[model samples]
Target: MQLSTAVERFLTAVQLEYGYSEHTLRAYQRDLAWFIDFAEETGARELADCDIELMRGWLWQRQQQGLAATTLARNVATLKSFGTWLERSRLVPGNPASRLRAPKAPRDLPRVLADEQMRRLLARVEGRGDAEHPESLRDHAVLELLYAAALRVSELCSLPITGLDAGARTVRVLGKGGKERVVPFGGPAARAIDTYLTVARPALIARAAQAASAASQSAASQSAGPQSARHDALFVGNRGGKLTPNAVYRLVARELEDEPGGGPRGPHTFRHTAATHLLNGGADLRVVQEMLGHSSLASTQVYTHVSTERLAQSYRQAHPRA
Candidate 1:
């Protein structure tokens, strides 16, 4: 069978049989397509004819093209998964990618905002130009939950209204790999979310209702796609649509830019800062890990370096018996 025909069968099998999401299957398909294109450019025609040297050469070419270590690692992983599928389907005698070693990626520690920076950022949110604006309220809520719950951006954006428990100061998050965990927040986050839910969310939903009414009148409406627009989405776009990851990133950046002497700010910065602050406050590693929804203690341990540096700085300034 042709390489394209076999790959199509494998992808279908993975989606139908293995129950992979469309997004995951598409990503794997893209990565494998890139590999196939590269192979064809280098005079290779079939999966069975490919060798370990060809795989290494492709990786070498990617490195030469200046791909980041993390991206290269993902590419290698995609290929490995593809190879496994191919081997299972008898398209290849063995998995070539199993023997291919991924390039060592640098363990760059996540950057965290200092306590002062966090304070300043929160201050900006509180003293907004207009409290009545729903966007302002949404921004405040987004920042509060991001810092307070130590959530990943996706988790924060994907949160349904049903997951929040303002009375209990806890939120249920659907994290990576479909793991469910309850993360608690302080009074500030709870208060911010309360304000948003009461003042802002309704206004946002009102806009969504308006859009839906308008769409109902348009001639193309009947042929239009079902409103993937979730009116119940906790954080909504200005257009009353669900907030996308890009919009979340941009929102963070705009808020940071508005702050005085703002450094880098993103959704992940809050997660890193929260973890570091928790460790600095003498919270146990396991507790911090649970708060951040980290599957491994090792993943949470990086924040210890941030706390250690802070401790060393304090010791230098305060220790008298040196």
Candidate 2:
């Protein structure tokens, strides 16, 4: 079988059978595509041409090009899965990448906001411009729910209108691998969402309808009917479409541009801050794991490290004796 053909089949099988998320599927596709191009360059176009040596050389070349350890680790994982599938399907003699090993990437602690910084940030957002403005209300709700639920940006953007329970102060999130979890938030988030739903959402929808009508009128030859369908998303963009992850990223980056942080200034920073704050307030590790929709306890343990670091910093500053 051709190498490219084998990769397509493997990707399809993973998507259909394993239900891998789009992000994971895209990563797998990119890594395999690069590998296939490299193999073709070396005159290895057939699936049978792939071997342990070829795989190792590809990784080595990427390493020489200065790819980050985490990226290389993902590349190795992608190859291993592809090779395993090829072997099982009788396209190759054996799994060429079975013995492949990923480099140990450094586990850098996630950046988190201080309590005072968080307070100031929230206050600033709440006080920005007119509170009655639809955009202002929506932005406030977006930030409140992001921090309150410790949600991933993708999760936040894809949330449906029916996914939230304001009375229960909980949200149903469809996490990675299609797993669903219910996360609870505080009263502040509840109030913000309630206000957005009651006031801002309807106004935004009206704005969207007006925009769509004007577009249809200008392009009357294209269609005489409604230009777009009503979106059921919990959050909508300025044009009334469902909110996108990139939109959320821009909003977060703008908000955090002036904040003191050495790492990324994205929506994940709010998630890290929320998790660390929960740990600092004596929340249980397992409870937090469930809240954050982390499949493993180890993923949740990092917040404990953040909490400990904060405590050590306090002790260093307040201790009387050296």
Candidate 3:
């Protein structure tokens, strides 16, 4: 079958069956599109005409184009998925790409903020910002929850009001691959969210509705349906819409712009910092994995390396013996 046609079918199936997110779907589609273009360059009529050797050539071409190991690995993975799908549909006799492989990418230790740095950073945020504006309150709550729960930016933004369990101090998060996990937060996050929900959110919604009222009566009539549906969104924009991940990035960037001792100034920096701090405080690896919603312990194990590196650095600096 045509490789491009097969790619479309596979993407649609994954979208419908596995519920892949738009971000994930776009990545896979892009990888497959690259493969089809490469296959055409090699004069293959369709995916059925391509074999393991051609797959290796495609990977080699990507490497020659200066693609990183991670990109090469992703391309190999894309081909494997396509090959498996082709086999299942009887377009190919067996999964040819099961034999495919790529170079392992060099893994960098996650950048963790020092305990003192985190304390100072959060304290600065607390003292510097105005509490009256809804956007300001939302940013505060979002940052607190991001650090408290080690949340991905997408997961943080998708959170709903019902996700918070105030009594238990836990937030039920829907993570990647549509997996749901309950993660606990601290008192600071709880208080920040309480202020945003009770004071800021209602005010923001009212402000949006009032503005819409003056603009168009038709907009006002239809507003109730959408507002009712989105009422559960934990964080909202100034215009009373679901807060997006990009807005979260800008909030974090603006807050971190003047902060000291930074490796990365993005939201994931908080995630890395939180995970490393948990491990430093002797949180169990398995427990941290569950809290972070990582599918594998290996993914969670990266923090242990970060923890050990810090320990080694401290020992070297403090010990008197040469």
Task: Give the Å error, residue 143, model 2.
Answer: 0.7
Where model 1 places Cα greater than 4 Å from the true spot, the runs are 9-27, 129-131, 214-216, 220-231, 258-264, 312-322
- In the range 102-209, model 3's lDDT, one tens digit per residue, is 789999887778888777777776665465677677677888899999999999888988998988999999998999999999999998888888887888788777
On TM-score, the candidate that comes out on top is: 2
C-alpha lDDT score of every prediction, in listed order: 0.79, 0.88, 0.83
Per-residue lDDT tens digits of candidate 1, residues 201-285?
7787777667667787676873462243555567777666677778879878876775554445677878888999988888999
lDDT of 2 by residue, 88-201 (tens): 888878899999999999999999999888888888888873545788889989999999999999899889989998888998989988899999989888888988889888
Sorted on TM-score, best first, the list reads 2, 3, 1
TM-score of 1: 0.86
Q: Is candidate 1 or candidate 3 better by TM-score?
A: 3
Sort by lDDT, top down from the best: 2, 3, 1
Error of 1 at 40 (Å): 1.2
- lDDT-wise, the better of 1 and 2 is 2
List RMSD in Å for every model shown.
3.3, 2.2, 2.8
Model 3 scores a TM of 0.92
Model 1 whole-model lDDT (C-alpha atoms): 0.79
